[model samples]
Target chain A: MERMKMLEWVQALCFVVVDMELYLDTHPCDEEALAFYRDSVENYEKAKRKFEEMYGPLTAVKSMDCERWAWADVPLPWEGVR
Target chain B: MWTYERKLQYPVNITRPNPAMAKFIMSQYGGPDGEIAASMRYLSQRYSMDNKKVAGLLTDIGTEELAHMEMIAAIVRQLTKGCSAEELKESGLGEYYIDHTGAIWPQAAGGIPFNACEFQSKGDPLTDLFEDLAAEQKARTTYDNILRLVKDHEVADPIRFLRQREVVHFQRFGEGLRMYQEQLDSKNYYAFNPSFDK
Candidate 1:
């Protein structure tokens, strides 16, 4: 239950970061928007770290962070309801 | 230069095995207005785009469209996974089945194979942005068409999400066009390709 919650949090943060990235793309010099983007990205990174420690790395770069090879153990996206 | 991400951008856990629907949805996979073309068009056009920020927008959105393309494949795979031979044929997938044996292929519902001619990489920034805007609308329309026919709840969920993304992308491309225009000569009937002209 807790793992799902944390993963959901991480996913939500990812959504924010993705939107802010595209938003920043068009409005490049908007200082306030940039601040929001930075804040969301920082939180997204933190949430991702927590999720990786408990679950596994979301990408190849973070795969080594785990003590064991948990990279292949994680469920793929198409398997079941995520 | 793309890194492999094990998970999809959006979750697609469809439990139904409806090959008929899969056949139609496959259009969005390889059809003229599909995600594959949308991604390719933006990524290819960005090379000659004069504006740096808009070019970056193309990269980000094009990357996201790849995710959308994957989701479509996942949905089609899940839809066809447990379907029997008769079901596959009855659903009008017999021709596709003979060729791929339930495996995913990039083809339109009408069996037209994916072609690069579906999109263009015209070097002009405004021209490319306008094409992008039209592409997003066409994608949104395709999703809308899919939604009307989709009875399965699991399948409809992500389709709706993908449809909404088209509207958002159109808005962003419009903004990108405006930003590019703002940098050009204000009161002139100049007719020249800014990307190629010095």
Candidate 2:
């Protein structure tokens, strides 16, 4: 997949996790919701790892894997280049 | 506490640079009905909310507003990127250019700096939730106006998403209000401030 496309997929997966988190916050003991959230989190982590390896660090703390400070080199989220 | 998420809720990849559109969209970043105000209002109000569910709603929605704020900033930043100084000036962005130089700052389209006065944390759940409902509608209206002015699909797409969120938030706040009301004597729902008087 293209870099942007991969990044977007990671984004969509993460958003699902976040939205599920909000629902789970209100319904904390719902077993079905917990299962769904766990599944989404697993998928999101996989996608995030793929994107970070190919592109660059998505978070400041995750920049340790790069040989260089790729964080500074990557296009900012606001620049709309990534 | 909040975790730092590095992606926008929706994507904004504007291929064209339009400083004029950027100016207008900046309002959603810092205007009276902007995300900053929405986040501030809810986050602050949560401290005094009478019910756990209502407080949870405030906290979650407030956090989402922060994300929306970043989304608006992304849109404005992308819109203004790669524009010439002459084009910026002609687009009536000269005053803003002098200060921020295409860098995003929290300000309304008219250049008014973001102020806390734009929102309220009334402390009373009923009062605060009503304000929240009104705030969401006002924000939706602002987004509607933005949609009317913005023609770019890239820009409008995210704006539409943000606008839809306002509608959803309004419904949630409405439910929050109903929840709070149900806890009170129907004849005397306004009997006292549940946040303080108990």
Candidate 3:
């Protein structure tokens, strides 16, 4: 849980840098920056997916299974270390 | 599902600590229309979004807001790092020092606590999307305000990155609105639907 929290913090930072660049590429279409942003996003997505696979959903709507909508079982990070 | 990570995706090496500058930036952490509110607003709104593309956009942007929240926290952490009690007292961070003691807590510059009142999730797709659009601009304006007050390069770099995102989100919302309108029109938008009053 501690490890997850720490990586989540770092990923938060990386997410912004990569996302802002991607936003630029969507319109400006700078090939180099777009390429970099795409790579960064893929890396972040992999990290995020892996983290969620282990930790559960970060937001209520973003749960692993959208249909079942399971939010009760998972203990939030702020609630406990386990 | 979201989980917090331990390591920084990109290292933010704060060569020099500036607590005052950190305070100004701290507003975004808790201030109305700030990152905490932005993230909560969009993420919650995603639940009501029936359309896949719009939901995807909300997920992407809302997740991004989580990052902005972290960026603000990181700035606060780096600025307060290694500061002595006396330095903190002298730097006007004494108020924050008393409460958090170098820990990052979300609050506006005037010290207003974080509140959901800063944002909304109306459950109606158009209303929520428009709210998201407005929220993005509000954040962009707040970033502009932050840029005006901040001088440190380490802080400014990330602030600029966040500011640009607001623009991007606005653009996405604009696109989302058009798509949403098209979807509505499939039922014949010429009916003069009163539901559009929102």
Candidate 4:
């Protein structure tokens, strides 16, 4: 997949994960939602790893694989250079 | 405490430049009822919330507002991109251009810079939650005002999505308030400060 397209996929999955997290915070005992949330988190993690390997770090704290501090070098999302 | 996402919550691919529309829409970017204020209000108020669920709601919604802020910036940026000096001046953006020149600065359509005074984060949970409910409505009204002026489908589509989110957030905050009230004494809900009385 293209870099931008892959980035979008990762973003979409993360959105689902974040949304589910908000729901689960209110309904913490819902087993079904918890199952779905776990699945989405797994997918988001996989997609994030793939994008970071090809591109640069997504966040400064979790970019240990980066040889240098590439977080500051990459184009921001608003720059449309993904 | 937050993860980075490289795409907008809703996609914004504006194909035309409309500096005039950009100026109007810029109000939502940094206006009194803008997302920046929304985010700050909720995030700051959460520290005083005694209920975990209510605090979680504030944190999640507050985080979403940051994404909404980015979306508004994207819309303004795309609209102003490639606009010429003559077009900007003709569109009544010359005063803004003289200061920022197409760069995205947080300000209202009338050129009021963003100020924390636009929002309140009173330490009292009841007061803050009510303030939040009112803030969401104000933002919804602002989006409605923007929709009245924006003609482009690209611009209106995302604005509609944002307006819907405001309504949803209003409902959630309402639920949070009810939940907090239910935990209070049946005789007098306001008898004590749940946050401080413990």
Give DockQ per model, in order: 0.58, 0.48, 0.09, 0.35
Candidate 3, residues B92-149, lDDT tens digits: the string is 8898889889888889988888887888988778778778888888889989988988
lDDT of 1 by residue, B24-114 (tens): 9999999999999999999999899878989999999999999999989999999998788889999999999999897988998899999
Minimum summed lDDT over a 10-residue window in model 3 chain B is located at B189-198
Q: What ordering of candidates by TM-score runs from best to worst? A: 1, 2, 4, 3
At residue A36, give the lDDT of candidate 4.
Answer: 99
lDDT of each: 0.88, 0.87, 0.72, 0.86
True contacts kept of 3: 0.08
* Top lDDT hit: 1
Number of clashes recorded per candidate: 0, 0, 13, 0
State residue B86's C-alpha deviation in candidate 4, in Å.
Answer: 2.4
Structure candidate 4, residue pairs in collision: none
Please state the error at residue A82 of candidate 2 in Å: 8.5
Minimal lDDT window, size 10, model 2 chain B: B2-11
TM-score for all predictions? 0.94, 0.90, 0.69, 0.88
Q: After superposition, how far is residue B47 of candidate 1 from its true place, in Å?
A: 0.5
At residue B153, give the lDDT of candidate 4.
Answer: 96
Give the higher-lDDT candidate: 1 or 4.
1
Ranking by DockQ: 1, 2, 4, 3
| Number of residue pairs clashing in candidate 2, backbone atoms closer than 3 angstroms, sequence gap of 3 or more or interchain | 0
The positional error of residue B135 in candidate 2, measured at the CA in angstroms, is: 1.1
lDDT of 1 at B5: 68
Q: Which stretches of candidate 1 lie over 4 Å from their true place?
A: A1-6, B188-190
